[model samples]
Target: MATDDKTTSHPADPARPGSGDKPGSRAKRAMLGAWFGFFVDLFDIYLPTVALAPAIAYFIAPDLGATGIAITGGMIFTATLIGRPIGAAIFGRFADTVGRKRATIVAMNGAGIATLLMALLPGYHQLGVASVLLFVALRLVGGIFLGGEYTAANPLAMEAAPRHKRGLYSGIINTGFPLAYAAVSLITLLLLLVMPAQGVDSAYAQWGWRIPFVIGAVLAFVLVAYYRRSVDESELFTKQKGTKTPIKTLFSGRNLSAFLQVFALMTGFWLSLQPVAAVLPTLLGADGIGMSSQATTLLLVVAYLLLAAVDVAAAVLSQRIGRRTFLVYAGAVMATVATTVYFLLVRFGPGNPRLAVVCTVLVVIVVVCPWAVLPAYINERFPTSVRASGYGLAYSLAVIVPSFYAFYQAGLGFVMPFNYTGIVLLGVGALTIVGAALAGPETKDIDFRAHADVSA
Candidate 1:
């Protein structure tokens, strides 16, 4: 499971004979394509939040009130979480069996079609309870595609990246989320300004909310075309083919330990990160903590911008410091300080936008840094043959359960009650730190090809 200390040398030109450059060159481009697809996927997934108010108004009866709509929307989000694991199972196996290129294509295209259909569907008044059912069904389908996208894309990027630069490359790929968030935020702002709002009734019933979904569908299609023309099968997969490493066998041989390790790591990561990352803004916004919608949007955009930069930097830093040490130290610091940071926000958040901004900045600095290095670290743990499936299954299982909890908490109007949520996050963070300290292997300067069984 350990990569050899000796480095493989090649000619200057990767395209020339005896040069190991072609695969490296191809991997770089493929990584870009994979991340581009990921960017679009993130955009589509988050766009719904911007339209949540309108969606509820259109679907729920006036007598039912906002609480009812909140509950319904929460259900949809939970349903979407359920679909993620299904997507991971189906697409993860396909990526291992068929190929990463084909699997990615299917995921991107399927998500696009699902979103487009959602854009066209009628509202509650027009379709009744059937409308809500249709929305949930479509979200489920979209979730499946989304589930497959990350599993295939992350492994593809990692396998393609140069060994020395894998951490940085992985970080760059993950930066797509923040970039997509910024883009979606900008788009939502533009739509809010331009769209004629004749109150919640007309906005939701007519066309306001559909605009973003339509735009996202178009973006998805565009990404599909881009990936189709630019991306190719990973060299690592080709090199490791015919090794008798089917999906089932992955859990049996040397890969078994690696799989468990990744599963445990991801579980802790998701449990600590998802709720804080995804739920905090909505929680703060709805709580009337003096952060108006415009101010909150501005703060999110700024935080994401910082997150994108820090994430990439952390990835590059891992090359010098080593992945294990970086994750362990960083995870511990974030976990230990997160509760204190939340307390700071709750204390100073009532009338002070400046203090709120500071708290926001602190949260991003802690949460996003460790997340940046994970894709590369996980990728280095498995062989190219079963990498996609392994990473997908592990990451999805970790994400789905925690994400469900996040939606449930939001639905129940839970927040920093006696610092309960913060305590939970801190515990998970401590677990991540402990896991890394105990089990994480140093991947610095290791040859990815030689370490095919590192997770073993």
Candidate 2:
């Protein structure tokens, strides 16, 4: 499964729009548009994680115990995740065959519509169980577009980026995740002050929850407009449009191994990220750690701000050393340091808000830092023709088994405390990342237009 693409390669095509040959206004605008699209992609994805988590009872009975709520909520979250691979396949083909800019616009518009419909959805009281079903369906649909967003945008930004600056560009592009998290946190925090997600009849449970979804919808539409106006298609992609089905080519012969390796690496990332991104906020809230809603969001905002900085630093460092080497060491730290902090997090649950903040910060940083290298590493692994398709599929395909993390937590609950299960998940994820990173070639120096510099 190892990649060994070590040949002299041509530079970016000088004639194409947003070419790295002369990094100027066009590349800058394309990069910004791609980054903004990704920012909003995560904005919608995290709305369910941060914005709707507290108010999920608005769709289900509040009388359901914590475990029951977790099951139902995970089901909702998993629905979205399940749709990602499907979206990756569908939109990956579209982006590879047609164009990144167009695929991205369609995805943004579709995601916006899905999010808008979610805000308009009636609660449990209005339609009984049917309301939850409809919510899950919409989320599934939303996840498809969300999957396509990064599939197209990341490659667009990377292709537009000068090879030397790819590492920095990758890190800058990824800041969208934590920044979006912070944005969602800030918005949700303000709403909690007025909405108050306490009971089925509470203001937040009724309407305040809808505000974030509405805002998320607006963000998606705004990105659509931005992309249509400012973004440019990948010159590399335009130069070599895949005549063969990109998806089929990925699973054929040697490309299959590359796909599997990417799948493995991304699976680890998704596993490690799930707890920090989705569950941690809830754990810090009144139920698990006894903090007020406002305090929890505040702590998350601080942690995410810190994470954004670390992400950039780590990505830049990866360029200096190598992506493979960085990931191996980072995965090691995640196994020991990150998991140990998680142990501290769960052990010291309830009271001690300051210590809780520290634990959460450490865990968040340790678990997510390796992610800084992935956009560049994965993009470097595949050639221009299949870059988006391979990226989309490899990225989203891995989330399948790991998306059942809540169920795994439930099963693990028999032998240990429910909260302690996160430690195990983190440890396992670390192993996968380390093992997969070891299999890949160093990719920082690969030219975007050089097929000989990448594995099939």
Candidate 3:
């Protein structure tokens, strides 16, 4: 077998890094575990965004105007975003002190259970505003569980990865984003065809939304069980002593600077992503450009399908170049090409659905390809002791600023047409990512064990 850093395992001594003593069984399992967590994370989280968009009226008051309804629906997302950082802080320290394996398992179970319960909730007609409150609260809890999960899972995978294959592994794991999203669109589309989506008495509004929640719950459990049975603790993490207070340690000295750089990049990523990923479907449909529900979902299914291939391709390319260099280039595209695509989409999309599809695909490609390099890039930014804590917070906490994308859109309305707001938001997000990438180091080959106070 090749070196463990390649596809081989290490020498029996856990303290040692590499010797190529065994086959890459451990590395393969670690990659599978990591991929499972990320896939399940996006699958469960986006079910509401894509699947529940039409059925949102079931849980909220029907009398709210267009803006009120938009804000109320966005509130569910807002609550989830609020919970993620808290989960990151809580679970990051737990993973640092306890073990990545244990933290991941517990988080998956919590999220899965929360999703299953969402399917059983009473609608607004049954319990009035309390039903909406309960629904939002459950989503918040689900977000926390999922937030904690990737904190442990991602670091474990990166630590176990061989140096040469880190980029490939990051690509494979991040593919979950597109594939899961595509699956949600497909599932919701099929359901919409079978169930009516219009009016107060439609089957979809009453309970069709619940079906996706149930499916998401089941996927989460199956993936978690597979992860538990197949994967072990990271060979490196097992050897090191645990940090007593990783969160506090993460905030001290240079770790803080590293965290800030990651936060800035991630914040931009979230801001740029939210408009296209979450809101575009709604805008393209009955709200903005005047497409049918089926047509809108079909477009998303196609875009996400294309993205799956593009994400892997981008990852491979980033591997050939460097993570920092590729991100800088991708950010530049987001600022320029992406904005141009959005303008094209808005201007031409109303009469030309095919052009709309092409524009959406291009926008998604430029804005999201940076993610293909990020797992390796972000994981390499810190040492083992605070890896989970730092990654979790940096990845999740920055979402708060971008979580208010709606308000930013609303604010943009004062200066320009509401329909054109996404273009400005994308530009702002693009600049932030480019600036952050320029400020950070090239982490393509940083040693995981360096630059930390390792415990005895």
The most accurate candidate by TM-score is 3
Show how many residue pairs clash in every candidate, following the order shown. 4, 0, 2
Give me the runs in candidate 1 sitting further than 4 Å from their true place.
Answer: 1-7, 12-24, 196-200, 203-205, 242-245, 286-288, 404-420
The residue pairs found clashing in candidate 3 are 4-8, 5-162
TM-score of 2: 0.90
**Regions more than 4 Å wrong, model 3:** 1-24, 62-68, 198-200, 450-456
TM-score of each: 0.90, 0.90, 0.91
How much lDDT does each candidate structure score? 0.73, 0.82, 0.82
The per-prediction CA RMSD against the true structure, in angstroms, equals 3.2, 3.5, 3.6
Better of 1 and 3 by TM-score: 3
lDDT per residue (tens digit) for residues 91-134 in model 3: 99989989888899899999999999988998888999898789
Model 2: residue 171 alpha-carbon error in angstroms: 0.5
lDDT tens per residue, model 1, 191-216: 67776455556554467778778888
Specify the poorest-scoring 10-residue window by lDDT in model 2: 1-10
Q: Which stretches of candidate 2 lie over 4 Å from their true place?
A: 1-24, 61-71, 198-202, 285-289, 348-351
